[model samples]
Target: MMATGGRRRSSESDELELGSSGESEEEMEDSSEDDQENEAEIQRLEEQLSISAYDYNCHVDLIKLLRQEGELEKLRSARQKMSELFPLTEELWLDWLKDEIRMAEKASDRENVYELFEKAIKDYICPEIWLEYAQYSIGGIGQQGGIEKARGIFDRALTAVGLHMTKGVAIWEAFREFENAILGTLQPSAGSILTPEQQEMVNAQLDRIHKLFKRQLGVPLLDMETTYAEYEEWADEPDEFVTQVYKKAQQQMEKRKPYEENLLAADPPKLAEYQAYIDFEVKDGDPARIQIIFERALSENCLVPDLWARLTLYLDRQLKIKDLVVSAHERAVRNCPWIVGLWKRYLLALERHQAEHKIIIETFEKALNAGFIQATDYVELWQAFLDYLRRRVNFSQDSSQELEELRSAFSRGVDYLKQDIEQRFGESGDPSCTILQNWARIEARLCKNIQKARELWDRIMTKGNATYANMWLEYYNLERAHGDPQHCRKALHRAVQCTTDYPEHVCDMLLAFERLEGSLEDWDLAVEKTETRLNRVNQQRTKAAEKEALLTKQEEEKNVQRKKGRSEKKAAKRAQKQALPGDKRKADQEEWGAQIDQPNKKPRAGELEEAEEEDMSAECGLFGRENNTRILETPALQKQKAAAAARNKVLHDNSKDDLTVFVSNLSYSIANPEERLKEVFESFGHITDIRPVYSNRGLFRGYCYVEFQEEKAAADALRLDRQELEGRPMFVSPCVDKAKNPEFKVLLLESVMIILFF
Candidate 1:
């Protein structure tokens, strides 16, 4: 029992000690919990203080929290507090006004809300603050009130900002926000109040946006991709801000649906679709539709000739009749005469139709009149006409008399063409070889007069510089046809001359000439001409080598001259630098030394005299050396000789006079100089002196003049003029009759009119 009691006491003491320790730990835990609560409270207070430090930030936070909590009234309360706390800050005032707007909108008081926002924005000078306020008001009062209120608000803000117009950032931001407000209100669902013209203005603005930033709202498919980012930035807002974007997309999709369906439902081509088609006689060929497209294309802002021509081709393909095809082509030509391809196609179609000779002739003349058939085209047309004649006339079937009559007609046409070409050549002596050759060939083949043909060709080659390869070939063919060896040889020589400077042409023409002659001399001459042409080509190729050699020599000489010039400049600079400084220093030191020596020097009678004598000798010797060095002679006589040589060269160059003058007496009169001048003459000297006594294009002065080197020559020309020249006589006489020679003033007036006519 005693042991049990002792053990129990000890256990009780230990338990007690343990309980005390537990109590201490419990107290510490309680203290720690209290400290935690105190710290949390302090942190909460610090956060509240920091948030409410700026009234603007405080109002914003409160509004955000109230909105999250669905307590708009509390948001209003906080915003009011913010406005009262900082009434001068438009941000706080705007926030308060926006909260009021939210409340008013919640109560369906749109007018009151708009008025509040409008007043706040107007009274606010801060663009950014007012802009933000306007955006928030938009959220509460919907787009109409928001946009209307915003436009007025922003206009005032802009006017206020105008005072500080140099503030570009503020001005641009205001404009951007204004545009945003306008865009936000632009939804069909938002119930826009725009009239038709106002809607059009909005649409135009939207189109401009889409065009400038293609991927944004209203861009075309063809717009470039570079605009995507810009469009994305402008459109990177909540759906509420960009509500009408999807509506536009839907409208676009809806507009395209019918066209797309029409395109899709279009049937595969069927022969039956070509209806109203006389030839193919099918249904639904859509010729009328194609014609409509053609007409529409013709009516486009700028007519496209190619498109019109293509449409005509489409119509012809659909109709599938040669007559309709030709008709459509002719219609296109009449409509668009400047379209050469269409005209050509029309001509081709006419050929296909096998039009009568008279019709073809009329068509050709009409084409020429319309300025559609160029020289080359005329050649093609002529060939086609000949082919037609060959096919229809059947020379073997026709009698010799008919054949001769046909040849006579061809001769008349050739004569007309030769006269035309000769007139042109007389006007402009250097006529194109192509026209000349065409004229010659037409005469040769159709006229069937070999002499006339040869004369035409000779005239062409002599006058038109007809050295083309084809000319030589034509000449050779003519010679071969005439069975003239000398003519053939002459043509071959001309061919050689034509190819003399071109090695490739030489090789080809020489070989051809050899083949024509079939002689060893011909072959040898060909080889010689070809080798000479080749050597000439080589020399020409080496011309660059000579130029390079000259350039290299010039470069080396330039380098030498540059180096010498640089060295001379450096020497002159150094000499000038050295001479100035040395002379200055020597003069200063000599003056000082002389002053010192003069004061200290003393002399006996004979010693002073000898010293003076020695000084005089030294000065004389220095002066003599300076004079000898400075008095060098220049070679001006050499320049005088050069000038004399140049003068003599000028004298020699001017020693000859190559000009000769022949004066005509105005007293010698041609009765009708205009009529006589119009008469054809082969040479310039055909009339001794031809002068028109006309004042204008058609009027004639009474007295006319003509003179010749010999008086009898003048008389003979006057007789011919009277007999054959345009049915009028030209007066001719010596200048002894001074009455016919009018005063200079009268002559000047007539001459002025003549100049005007000419």
Candidate 2:
């Protein structure tokens, strides 16, 4: 209900006038209502921040709301909280700086503003912030610090972003103006030359201004021509070195202009262009320029953890500025706290720099609470923290505070995995229990405390790890390295009893251990134990194998019985139907979709004509037989028939004579023989019809008749004679009744033409 500036619009508000019937009578009442709504909204935003500290937009919205209501304290808190997690934008920093500057009353408040400026510049290289910083420092010149402090800030600002292509000129100009302002104050009189000391003061101030101008001109930035022209106008005499530096800077600026122009032409967070720009700066081999470009890119793409990581890597490897490297890592983790790698890298960076023990521990605690998505991330983070703690321990000293802390962290991590991690992720992330393994190793190898190590290994096995042969071997190896032969033999004996996955490997390990360190009776006992365990395991496996084989045999017999029953039932039904059938043609027509063919048995002489004559008489006509029979044709059958006709009409319907090729010797198990035959001979010419012969049960009978569009196409198709269909060579012969056409012979074509003109 709280209005977001002017964005919250409603139809009711649009319909109402200023003094509408439902309007508040007094402006004070209306204002109080808005204040309450804003208060509620502020509370909601703050609550959201509490729930999700990394909610970047929520923080920004809260800060904006607080600033709008002039809740100075709340605004400061909101901005600080947001900046702790995310690098603030230049706009947010400017707003924050301006507010601090306006509210700052005492010398101490001014110093706080200075500290705020320092934090702001670290987030991004904003010349405006630098300009603001310099200007703010100018106000403090008379209060406590003198002009030198202001000059020092301006100089640092120029050093940071002085090589900036477009905005670097602003900082240079501001520095010069501040120096000029100081110069004016240092001059004794308006018309007379100063005394030696005073004159020296004025000259030194002029030299500072000169050096700033020279530095500005030497750097490749936007509006260098303006700087050069201004320099020409201001200097009493021309300096060729300055001119050459200006020319060189101009050339460099021209080279950089295209990239900056692309940045301006593209949208915000132009990552691709910025990457190309970063490559350009890095190729120049200037650390200062590379760092500046990286900061500029990060200003827009702060949420991009990769960008921050790259910047930090570059600083660590190339620049080696400790503050910048630490800041980069810290900011990377802030921007991407959920990224475990970033947190790990931050811990390393902090430790590499030998940061305070308290700060490092605090950072590790924050990483533990960073709410990583994967349970493995938590495991890895704990491992990192444990490694840091272990590094701090003096192994030479038997008992140290660092060693105690490390041991405590180890126990705490294991407990956390058991209760918290397993509850959240449904299983402990460390399936191998690497943390416990490390702890045992540390206790054995560093503390030389085999008893403690043995205790740890016992816990490891009890935590759902008893069955693993590898774990047993791991414990055995550790005991062998750090414990006595008696303990080693004990560990191996327990391993042989408990190892299930590879009991033979552990048995062999125990035999090897007994050979090296056991007496004759001890070796005899070990052999007996090994033989018994192997015999039991082999017996159990043999029984399981026999049971599995029996079950498989039973399954096969059941399958055969079921299949025979289905065949017998089908046979009986078919026989009864054939015996009781009224009209064979009608039955064939009804089962047309199934393509059930008539029986292959030869009929008695004249029996077919007699049956046809009787069927015709009963239906009044053969073509009108549908009226008397239960003939059914679904859309799928019709579509199949239509597709058959579209490819080529059947041979009986065509006018062409002797164009049908009889194809035989196809694979009986081949499905869709018509389509398969067509594919084999389709390259010859247009196919007229493909009729695959099927038996009464609708099974392929290994033969079909393919009628072509022309006799030549049929002749060409005959060239595929003995060519394979479904791995069986087929006979593609002309469709001739041998008794009727004795003279007909299948002459293989040496050359053939498909007669499409026919």
Candidate 3:
């Protein structure tokens, strides 16, 4: 008994010594501090979860904290809760399973580990987990029925992950290794012979190994060529069937080589190449390979939300795996937090997956805080959320919580757009007033609350929508459909008054409404109001038309006058050019003779006839006149000359009467001077002609004659004397011969005398 006591003491001393050697006091203190930190983290996570049960990050943190604290019960509960709420990621499952498996000590405990392994495999066909499961089952082969149980697990794992191109080889090799071990156990001892039953078992096990090698060789897995070569070396006699399978797989591998080569040669963010590869894998229809390719692409293109969206859509539609689809959606929104479409799609996906009500609300709140790039984006997002809420409400229930919540959201949305969106964007995003219209519609149709509908319409109008005839008509129709006839009449009356853009349409609508449901008195009042308003509108339109016509008539008159002046000026220039030079010379000689006060030389008849002949000869041609015979004037010729002289005297008398003005000092380079001068002087009075003097060479001579149709017009034009024309002062004087006007000379002398006296 003393010896037994000493042994117990020695064992206790060794335990203390082991504890002391394993951890110093500083290490122990650090460990205690770590435990305190973990506990504090747990408390913080729990507090956050209480505040927001939908906080996914907080749930994750709490799970990690409990697992680190080795609180198995709490950790299991946390994981279970999280699994129910969210799909666990591959890494999270691995961590949880590892912790669970390490804590198992009994057969029942091992059974729990098996259940976890099953759960993990269902979440994703992960080859590593299947291999671990197979190997774990192999360790229990010594118990009753353990060998067959282990064999069954290996077979199940092979079927589950057999098509994984990159990681599948591990499971295939593990299965074969288990079968080979069984084959060794069935073999007789070194020098002994095996019984018939044992011999048959060994042959069956060997056949299993051969079948596994042949199956693996046929698959187009990564490093499959190495597996084929290894099988050739391991098999006692290589099977022709195995060789044929390897060749077929090689052909497939060749077909896939280019895609793999492209992936390797691409630079970072190889989205195009990955998309091509993904399409190929999808067509191949191996979910495991498709998933692997997606993961490979996302590692390089994590920020590409479209890639995430595509993967999520595929998982949702094809796989229909709730956890995977939800996880992809969550990651997609997290990667592109500011994309409103991503958040909107996430909300829809949540609803489709039947997420908790509080979780959907929290997600919507987070979406609102996502800071969209435009006011319209906010409206669309709000519409999506409202659509979800609308789907949740049962219209039959008049006063349910959902109905109240829907009404509250409508009110908040309107105020938010008016106060927040307008303030930031400088214009209301809800230009169509869709939210208010929807609210009014809901109140009218579903709630049977016409008063609330009326209030909403009033608010819509006060927001500057009253001018629209359609808006008023909408209100009228709503009242007609849901309210009493009196309210409909009131709505139409207000519409007629407030509708400015399309008053006639509103008036017609009021008349139609009255015709449908009105007394004789109402019909009379409607007709009177419609006629009075129409008459007022017609009068205003007529006044505007008269003013416009007056302006147009004035403009047309100005254009006509301008065109007439131009035509007259052109005619005068053509006439001036065609006038004979002899006429000009004769006028100059007459003026010179009058200035000298010489009596006209009246030659004898014979001398007059001879002088006329000489003038005609000079005009015809010098050489031709010498050979031509002269003819004596007849009685008709003498009469025609007397008539011309009489007409010339009449023209001279009209010139003296101030019917023409002589303008000089004009621009020599003036183009179309006759027309330009008409434009300037026609403003005074009616001008008959403007004759600009030109040189024999067809150039302007800086002087012109302006003849008026009336003497008063010439007098009025004299007021513009000495006015600047083309940067030179123009001189205007009566076309009267100065030598014939003795009174004008006497007046000039008197003006000189007055200036001298002053």
RMSD to native for every prediction? Answer: 42.3, 20.5, 33.8
Runs of candidate 1 exceeding 4 Å displacement = 1-292, 299-302, 314-323, 354-356, 371-456, 463-465, 474-486, 500-504, 511-517, 520-758
In model 1, where is the ten-residue run with the lowest total lDDT?
Answer: 652-661
Among the numbered candidates, top TM-score falls to 2
| Candidate 1 residue-wise lDDT, 1-758, digit = tens | 12321111226666568667765767757865965664465445436745654434435555555544444544455555544333334545655565565456344575666555554433223555545544554454455455556556555544443222122134434445556556656645665467897788778666544432322323111121223334556657424433355345345445434433443354322111222121221222435334432332243211346655665677555665765576666555555554456655665567667766677667656654444323344434444444444444444442465455445545544453456534544433224444445445544554455566677678767764455666667666776775366667666666656643343663675577577665887678777876776677678779979999999999999999977876886676465445664574464456446646675455454344334433333333333432221211112222333334434432111111111111122222444433544353212233443334333222334444333344344333432322222333322222322243344356456545643443
The numbered model that scores best in lDDT is: 2
Model 2 per-residue lDDT at 18: 48
> Per-residue lDDT for 1-758 in model 2, tens only?
33544233345555366447566567747776998999899999988888888766688789889898877766787788777777788899999999888878987898799899989987777888998998888877885556779889888988887777878778888878878888888877668877899988888888877877788889988777788888988787857898888899889889899999999997556887899999998998888889889988987887787888888878778876678889888878877778898888888888988899999999999998888988999999999999999999999998999999999999999999889999998989998889999999999999999889989888888888888889988888897788888888887888889888899999999999878888999999999999999999999899999999999999999999977876886686466446533564565555453433543333344343334333333344334543554433333334344444535633343334468787776777876777777788888889977887655334566677888878789877776776666565667766655444343432222111111111
Model 2 alpha-carbon drift over 4 Å, by segment: 1-32, 47-54, 84-86, 184-198, 250-262, 518-758
1-758: candidate 3 lDDT, tens digit per residue: 12421111236666578567875767757866987888788888888877777566678878877766666677788788777555466688889888877878999998999888877765455667788889989978988999899989988876767765667789888888888888777878889998898888888888888888988898777788788778878886799988998999888777777887887786546787889989998998878668777866775676687887888778878997776777677767766666778888888889998999899999988878766767887888888888898889998876789988998898899899889999988988888788889889889988899999999998999988988899988888898789999999988888777777788998998899888899999999888887777777779889999999999999999999977876886686466446687764464356445535633444455444434443444345334544243333333344445444434433234434568887877778887887899998998788877766655334567777888888788988887776788887777876655575555676456544543442
* Cα error of candidate 3 at position 339, Å: 8.3
User: Which 10 consecutive positions of candidate 3 have the poorest summed lDDT?
Assistant: 1-10
Tell me model 2's lDDT, rounded to 2 decimals.
Answer: 0.79
TM-score of each: 0.31, 0.66, 0.47
**463 in model 2: Cα distance from truth in Å?**
0.7
Error of 2 at 432 (Å): 2.0
